[model samples]
Target: MFGDMMGMMGKIKETQQKIEETKKRLDTVLVDEQSNDGLLKVTLTANRQVKTIAIDDSLLEDKEQLEDYLVIVMNKAIEKATAVNEAELSAVTKESMPNIPGMDMFS
Candidate 1:
């Protein structure tokens, strides 16, 4: 029984290490999302920090409209980034434990 417990603990530790490494690797990854019409684009880190934003010159002609479009595009980009982050986290969590009842390890 003790041996089995120790083995389980070791596996838990290994999983923890893998999670940490995945987080570190994710921090360096950037996700790029663009508007459907290609008028705006945004790059965001896996941690959800905005890296860069690109706007087409044509949109500059109308300041108010441009502002509105910017807001819309940025929101879309952020939503996409959030979805991607969630998917990645979910995948990592799933791989770490295939079956564990009442144990929300990633939480």
Candidate 2:
């Protein structure tokens, strides 16, 4: 029983290491998205931090429409960034988890 416990502890350490590496990988990921008409573009990191925003000069003539376009484009960027983060986390989870019976990976 004690030997099993030691092995489980080793697996836990390995998972922790993998998760840290995954976080670093996620930091390097950038997701970019644009509005349907391509008048606006938004870029964000996989960690969901806004990186850059671009707007076409034509849209500057209409305040309301420009605001709507910005909102739409920002939402798209956020959604894409979220997907990137989730995919990274899922990869780490799958890589870390062992097929050990009666084991709760997170517990």
Candidate 3:
């Protein structure tokens, strides 16, 4: 029993390291989103950090419209980034987890 416990502990530590590495890699994974008419564009990392935003010159003339476009585009980009981040982390965690009875939470 002690040997099994020790192995499990080691596996958990390894999984933690993998998770951290996956997070760092996610920082380089980019997600892009744009307004329906392409008036606004946004690029962000899978870690949800904004990288760039581009807006049409016409949008600058209408403050409200520009704000609306920004909100929509940014939200969409964030949603995509969140999905990518979650999927990558989940895959790393599930793959590294030790197979123990009643510990199938990742399933």
Candidate 4:
């Protein structure tokens, strides 16, 4: 029983280390999303924070349309970044517990 407990503890420590490493890696990753035939593009961090946005000068003429497109593009960028972050975190969590059934602690 003691040996089993120790093994479990060891596994937990290893999993914790892996999670930390994954988080660090995620911080350095960026996801890009675009709209309006790529006329508008947004870059976001893994944490869904906007990093940058690029807009074509051609769209500047239509102020209302430009505003609407900016909103849409920003939303899409955030959504895409969130989806990617979820996927990456999920993959790491799953890898750490491959045999656990119905274990969605991360989700």
Lowest summed lDDT over 10 consecutive residues: which window, candidate 1? Answer: 98-107
Q: Which candidate leads the pack in lDDT? A: 3
Which has the greatest TM-score?
3
Each model's lDDT comes to 0.78, 0.84, 0.94, 0.79
As a whole number from 0 to 100, the lDDT of residue 16 in candidate 1 is 79
lDDT of 1 by residue, 1-107 (tens): 99877876787787778778777776788888777888888888776889998999998899997888778877876777778777777777777753546777555
For model 2, residues 6-92, the per-residue Cα lDDT tens digits are: 887888789889888888877788899988888898888898988888899999999999999988888878888898888888777
Instruction: Give the Cα-based TM-score of candidate 3 against the true structure.
Output: 0.94
How far residue 45's Cα lies from its native spot in candidate 1, in Å, is 2.3
Which pairs of residues have clashing backbones in candidate 3? none
The best-first sequence of candidates by TM-score reads: 3, 2, 4, 1
Clashes of each: 0, 0, 0, 0
lDDT of 3 by residue, 1-107 (tens): 99999999999999999999999999999999999999999999999999999989999999999999999999999999999999999899889999889988865
Using Cα atoms with residue i matched to residue i, what is each candidate's TM-score against the true structure? 0.71, 0.82, 0.94, 0.73
**Runs with alpha carbons beyond 4 Å of true place in candidate 2:** 100-107
